[model samples]
Target: MSAHDQLLVVIDPVARRIDGESVRIAKDVLCAGAAAKICLPDGPEEFSRALTRRGGRRPVVVGDDHALLRAVAALYRGRELGDEPLSLVPVGSVASVELARSLGVPTGAVAAARTVLDGVARPLDLLADDSDGVVLGDLCIPAEAAAAASVLHPASVWDTCRSLVRTLVRPAPPAPAPRAHRLRVEADGVLLSDLDDPVEDVRVRAGDGAAEVTVTHPRHTGAEPLRTLAKVVTVSGPGFRYRADTLDVGPVRHRTWTLRPKGWALTLPPAGPPE
Candidate 1:
């Protein structure tokens, strides 16, 4: 295969040093064989447009976890407009290590590029907020250190350190007792939990409903509390604050959020024929 048969690529400039290098190497490898056009985006907006306009062209990303998140954002922004599959070449430090490993991307740049060029297209699930902010992965809301989190990225080293400290060593003060809110929370019209009483370390999540919803409370001694997957979660506060994935938005008086699955066609290393 040659670069001409491959998809276009967009590399993030700020995606850690190693990621940039890996992207360069991946570009060379992808282009050498497929004749793919590589377009290094100056910013997120341009990348979104390129992805939207070039639906026939597979778009590959070269960056850290955030780079992939940016691409996901663009995909959601153009969800109704296009359905081109996405490819990624992970090039970051520890942050991208998990995503790369999970996706079966090789550690070596050339190997990862080969995977991208040889991968398959599959639909991936995503979570979306009311404001259209999408969470590609997990979302955590801490009760103890909410203040510190406001200052830094949710996944940042500082936040991680603080989380560890609060969880392991010196625990921070719990969030002020939950106040009475005039909102109702229901899942499939079934009452799961209500906030009339002051609650601490509350969590709500959506899942396959095969089992129970996982909830982790602050300063809990051993077991993390669990709840069932509800169709809806309604939150009402004077000003409610919630973290969706990596982005934060809200403080609205009353808002209802539901867990809905979104499909995204993604390009991965082509799968082998079934035995």
Candidate 2:
């Protein structure tokens, strides 16, 4: 088949700059010099079903960051990434800066499509949860994020507030909280830290083959957050909550995760020179 043949484009209706005109421009550019067509979605569920029914065609997403996350989640839910490429053009206000920054997608929709048509696959990583939720980006454990968790299932005013306040609030300073969870973390048989004593939260990250786990004391204000690369990280606690990207995921008792390299690749806009 030709480069653009059998390509399926799915866009998020709510994504920024996603009106018909921008999408048509992407269709023109991505299919230039080849044969292709773009399909619009009524909503996320239809988009997911459309992807599942698409046979052998590569799937491309034309939406903002949340849309991209939804697409990725759909692929995982449908189990279609074993032999397909997932491309994206961030078309919403909250662009996939972190995803695009990592993948090198340009901001211009046309340029982003060019990357897709070129068919390059980079070794990417995905985080898989015990509940089968796979995250391609950051996970959060903010003090006030819990309020948002309660209304995660169906859209509610409380959940809406939880989502709104998180990105708006400045990262809280580190101040110890009165309550803490006693726990133990082991990395490849090495006992990294044993907080049988008491601590607020713990983080176990898997990037390389090794693991990095951190346990923090209970503070009213959380300290500077830690980002790391490890192969596998596990967490076991009494009762806790966390957020992955924009999705509120847990109150999980025991959860473990690791990076799935080359799990999926996205087409990104090019980057400008660093400051």
Candidate 3:
């Protein structure tokens, strides 16, 4: 590798937040070590434009979990993720990026940024849904609705103001607390869990060309969960939502995710477990 390797470092707004000292540290280390171009976009649209305008430069995201997901999704939509290996620098809220940390990204800002410059590119899998969405980690059904509020943003200030006005005009009931949902889960068309019994949880993980599906329910006497491996897993139930990584997506009665092997590559520590 040459000292002239150039990286397009896209810093998310959350990483550039006023209290984000860790993000600042990561930026400094990245710039000092390599020929890096930092793009600080104010919002999602700007982020997309910056990424689109990055010609012949590798992209390195500097943000928390959601930011990383968004970057991957943007590239995946353009059908460019497979050709380019992406790098990540985890910053912002610690609890928010458990996926990044668990994936072996150094929690420390400097170490993660250094990884962008010196680490090896590791092939990874992805869960691509029929709706054109991609999930890099576990996806769970029947997640808390309040979690959705935190991840989704209003389209504009007018939308925010309208929401506030509606809230004032009609005092809404308390949001429904998280609860189990009845679902019929099938792994490769084989029934895994029936809707007759309440499903406490449903998790789908991407593996090397397959998906690890886990279904959990209340046990009368320690009944074990139902688990299986499949290339595609479908969940159908009276409209249900799911949480993929940190983002919430759903309300559809039926959804399926196909496992993609070697979907993309990530810069990771040269010697260690995959993060």
Candidate 4:
């Protein structure tokens, strides 16, 4: 058989715990269609080693979004993402495998396995951050919008003293009111919002050759959000956490993400005309 017909099936331990039946089904289908060497990795280290040791065989991940992300991240770090086309057999909770589904990978075990056996490799865009982070889908600032606006604030000396006094004297302290964040957002060197303007939300999505950015201001109730397409997006402000795909990252003061067009490839079912 050709190299393309040989697969290194990496089954994540989480997948085995979440849904063993689906994993079995996927394995059976892939093994029947192609020469598949199953690798039941116990943890992240084994998983990485399995992929690293795979020679001439296409890697097929059988797990959730985290599993898929891990595989892609490994290839990306090795600078082999473009050279290798990855396949997935998603076997986890709906929310856990949402990323794979969003990327056009079938959630069904049989369908996903069949796609791996006979499918087209499609080029996909991704966001690469300055901190060596990769975003396969979209990213949003203040991971939890409601909590972010209320919690992400720099406390002054007086504020800290007052809090301590309140904790010692008061039996119950009132919750802080939610407030807009003072962030500076820039898209491709074009300033979308400054620190003077309070922002309600910020989102960046990977597009064809650029990222689509949207910045919303709390003051502008009915006004449209500031939107633009840019190859680079930068957000600077007080230390804040953001959600990239399924991961919540950083209390970072500043972050920059660049769009890498067609940076990765995935094996997906053949495209059909829009219904």
TM-score on alpha carbons, each prediction? 0.69, 0.71, 0.81, 0.85
Best-matching candidate per TM-score: 4
- Least lDDT summed over 10 consecutive residues: which range in candidate 2? 142-151
Model 2 residue runs over 4 Å out of place are: 3-5, 16-20, 94-97, 145-186, 189-197, 200-215, 218-229, 268-275
The 10-residue segment with the lowest total lDDT in model 4:
143-152
Summarize candidate 4's per-residue lDDT along 1-275 as a digit string, tens digits.
89999999999999999789999999999999999999999999899889878989999999999998899888888777888799999999899988888888988999899999989899899999998789999899842334423354679999998878988997764554446778999998999989998877899999888899998777446667888999999999987788999988888999999999999999999862111
Q: TM-score of model 4 relative to the true fold?
A: 0.85
Query: Compared with the true structure, what per-residue lDDT tens digits does model 3 show for residues 1-275?
Result: 45327889999997788337887888888888888899989999889778777888889998888888989888888888897788999886678878888777877788898888889888899999988799899898854443434466647989988978998999777765556678889889899887887777899999777889998875443669888899888899988989888888768899988888989898888986444
CA shift of 187, model 1, Å: 3.2
Candidate 2 per-residue lDDT over residues 1-275, each given as its tens digit:
75445678777777524466667777788677355556777887887887787776778878766777787787787677656667776564434445555445665666677767764655466777666677666654433322222334676898788867985896864554345555554444455445464555555443443444555655554554333445666666665677776677667666667667667755433343112
Report the Cα RMSD per candidate: 9.4, 9.6, 9.9, 7.0
Candidate 4: misplaced stretches above 4 Å? 143-178, 219-222, 272-275
Clashing pairs in 3: 103-275, 104-275
Cα lDDT listed for each candidate: 0.59, 0.62, 0.83, 0.88
Model 1 TM-score is 0.69
Clashes of each: 17, 19, 2, 0
Instruction: Answer with 1 or 3, whichever has the higher TM-score.
Output: 3
Tens digit of per-residue lDDT, candidate 1, span 181-267: 333345446654355533344444434431123343333334446466654555554555666544565665665555554356555
